[model samples]
Target: MKLTYYPGCSLEGTASDYAAGIAGVAGLLGLTLAELPDWNCCGASAAHSLDAEAARALPIRNLRLAQRIGLDVVAPCALCFNRLKAGAKDLEAKGERLSFRVWDLLDLLTQPVFLKRMAARLVTPLTGLQAVCYYGCLVNRPPKITDAPTPENPGNMEKLLQTLGATPLEWSFKTDCCGAGLAVARPDLIDRLVRRLYDRARRAGAECIVVSCQMCQANLDLPQARISRQAGQKYELPVLYFTELIALALGHPEVPRWLARHLVDPRPVLAAKGLLEIPAPQASG
Candidate 1:
């Protein structure tokens, strides 16, 4: 029920809500998230692009700490997860000499015992939700990070969706790009990517788009209005972090907390469907 939780830099700052949401839901799910004693950035895109050794080394430090404590690490950030996963895969593949040891957070979280425990704790009814799970291009690509189901067609998220009682909509955009960092530099390109995903999700009859990558969520969720305007089509799918949907399925009352900082509000869609529940405040410990 417990694993070393690496919140990464984003989770500690602007994405604090994601960290809280994970903590809150983990409590309800009877899961224990133990934070690493000292953790640093996994050097996601920046590190990998600048220096491969440093990029691998950053995640190795955290993983080494986890291995030392005899507990596997669980990274909530997609970029961090990808970095750590890539490092572990490289080490495993080439038997590379390591100044430190490392392991994939997915390795621990997806273990049968942990997954079963998580499924057992998911009691909130999800009879009404039809979600299109998006894994984006980071964690699943380059073949080094995610190990199973291939990048072109992924099912890990769908498996988790089924376990939580929601129907996973079949869609081609699950593993497609959301135009990522290009959102700032080349919004026109990002607009095309977003429109493609939005159109596909709508065609597949998804109630909302579920994502694990924060950057992907930021790109797709925030700019829906602008993208729609540019494409000259009405698109209004509620984009959410997978953790947020999991929290809702766990019967947490504070659903709105997850969307407070979102550029587009999804409360109306949930409200229109009569699934919006005022999330009750949790007593601070």
Candidate 2:
């Protein structure tokens, strides 16, 4: 099960932890990942807004790179997955048939082969952790592009969580927008959106929020304090990446490093569940 991996810009930059977790989990699952050579940005949330042609071209270029390697592409980032799927659709519309497939990591995990491997590798089952799987806006929108069965009510993450011994809570706002890419420009709106998500997750008795998008993680994790302050409430929820949880279940050595990168500390939550040990600070001169 070798695939051309596209880490994309976000995975290389702000979401490097995601990249690590994916790589680690893939290794554990015996899935070989060959990175696309010299790949460029997929022109995420901004590309289509400015120029449709450029947006399509950027991802198509990467798809061609994957084709050269003669393998399907696996993009872990939701925005990257959407852009690549859109690019393939654009080419198909123009009568250009591509030789390979583009798969979101979530889609790949749903396969029986991967699920079997993942179950065998789970040393520490995440028992008693109630979570709401947040799909954000782009992962499964426009049905045709993403090929998601129920875009409004996705269950991929929930299914994956169940296999790892975690409880995926039922809740609304699963597919609602988390103010994607508008964090800086219209934070007021973002705050409101985050608040709604938090309120719902809490109402559903979820201890944390699990997401597949880096943008959603940032909006939900980083702005918690301010959003809480603005709403005259407190939200101490731990927002985690699906990959990170997989790494924890697989007992990956770097799980601590991945957990350390979160804006909202997840150690407390993990510690409470007896799932992690907070490493002691290093002695310094």
Candidate 3:
């Protein structure tokens, strides 16, 4: 299906790997993501804290751009999705409305049709890989604003992983804050937050933490070594984007490049699964 794609700020910078996964698997999943041209930032975390008006306005402006394209808007970034959804809610509060719907990338992808396409193209299944899905707040919290079903315990990531043949472990930190918003100003606090998540996930027998948010990935992946050094223990869990794993399962050519950009190396664990190189599927008779 065709849809307007809003990548937000992270995809171009810290989350480029996420972008690559989307690009690699879009066609296989029957998606046509036409980038919203002239799109600007969705005011991520700063605008909402400082200027409420701009927070609403920024995402609204991008939503208008999507409306011009006359298709539903699909924002991959959790912050972007939250911001746009908040803007849409604001429009309704003011008795103004848009012509198109806004969809979080996870919500849109887990639908039956998309799942069918994904299953059809699955040449490799992520069997025996234990992981926990990290929602990182904002995406599904404040459910009235985001309209997420079961915000406290979202199953989108788990369902998607199940379809890919991966075991998604249930954990209490599923929707916990990753401390991304405070990472810069209060790294000491953020470090504690990351440490808690790492220790929890590993204790639950997960080899990695699966995330849909770039901020969460950065928070967990970047400062790992430092945290390990400070604590005198190894918290070596690889924080991975769900898209990266999807691309690997589909044998997407761009998988290696995306995985390389990660700060904490994800290769060893992924390599142990024999997923480093995927063989092209043999032709059917």
User: Highest lDDT: which candidate?
Assistant: 2
Cα RMSD (Å) per model? 3.8, 2.1, 4.4
C-alpha root-mean-square deviation, candidate 1: 3.8
Candidate 2 vs candidate 3, TM-score winner: 2
* Each model's lDDT: 0.72, 0.87, 0.86
As a whole number from 0 to 100, the lDDT of residue 264 in candidate 2 is 77
The per-residue C-alpha lDDT of model 2 at residue 63 equals: 80
- Candidate 2 per-residue lDDT, tens place, 80-154, comes to 999999999998999988898899888887688877888987899999999999998787998899988899888
Window of ten residues with lowest summed lDDT in model 1: 100-109
* Alpha-carbon deviation at 144 in model 1, angstroms: 3.7
Taking the tens digit of each residue's C-alpha lDDT, what string does model 3 give over 1-285?
A: 899999988889878778888888786676899999999999888999999889989998987877778899998888899999999999889897888888988889889897777788888899889999998898898999899889998999999999988899988999988789899999999999889999899888999999888888888999998999999998788888888888878877777777777877777787788777642222110
Tens-digit lDDT track for model 1 on 1-285?
Answer: 576777888787766766777777677656687888887788877788889899988977777776667655667766787887787776667885444333233334445665676677765656668889988876667664665457688777787777767789998778887878677788899888888888889889887888876777778877888977887877788777777766766667666767665556666655555556642233231
For lDDT, candidate 1 versus 2, the one ahead is: 2
What are the per-model numbers of colliding residue pairs? Answer: 2, 0, 0
User: TM-score for each prediction?
Assistant: 0.84, 0.95, 0.95
